[model samples]
Target: MTSSLPLLLLALCSLSAAEAQLTVFNLRASDLPSGIVVTTDGYVKVFCGSASLGETSVRNNDPNPWWEEKFTYFQGQENDVLRLEVHDSDIFFNDLLGVCQRQINFMREHDCFLESGGLLHYSYTLNGNNQ
Candidate 1:
């Protein structure tokens, strides 16, 4: 009985640990239009426009090159923030003439701009109501 008591206590502890779980709520531009809002209990809500929705992969210059090393990995139950990307149409020109004339100048001045690879990254907190 004494030997079994320790095993039983260990099992109960593991079960309790499993109950305090962390979950992720991922949102993208494709999920909804500009007016829609998403909520998470312990995380910040992110909104990305349609132009930024598509397949997302690890960023080229990401410090972690592994497939699972992106922002999504950091999501947890408590104290999390969501990330979002939106399109800047004024800066991106569709025509070559516009690109040569205005877009180039904008790019040079800004030094960096968001690209439309068709993906939006977002994270949300998980709580009883939002989960």
Candidate 2:
């Protein structure tokens, strides 16, 4: 019985470790444009577009318009890579703002957004380390 207990504990520990290592990739965007391919490693490469400016142009009046901020998330598994891209849409700024608002509301509802926290901080966490 004592030996069986040790084995059971070991099994439980292994199970917990597996669960802890299971990571999920989530991409929330208001719109996903066509002809966009997402890789496993999170590198967003634009294959084709109407204009070759690297990103969507916000101001058509300007000859040299600025590119919209492109957001992506990726995970690697040995030689395999998984990536997701949230391309900037025509109304990207507004969409991003809406996402931020929703996040703030969620944090507030969970009591995680404390007054002392001072203007909700957001940073990326990659490979078990905060970036």
Candidate maximizing lDDT: 1
Question: Residue by residue across 54-86, what tens digits does model 1's lDDT show?
Answer: 223422222211122222221232333223433
lDDT of each: 0.26, 0.24
Candidate 2 lDDT tens digits, 4-95: 88889998776544311112222222222222342111111221111121222233222122233442233211212222222223322322
Instruction: Give candidate 2's error at residue 19 in angstroms.
Output: 2.3
TM-score of each: 0.26, 0.22
Which 10 consecutive positions of candidate 2 have the poorest summed lDDT?
103-112
Candidate 2: where are CA atoms >4 Å away?
20-84, 88-131
In model 1, residue pairs whose N, Cα or C atoms come closer than 3 Å (at least 3 residues apart or on different chains), thus clashing, are 43-125, 53-118, 54-118
Which residue pairs collide in model 2, if any? 39-83, 40-81, 40-82, 40-83, 41-81, 41-82
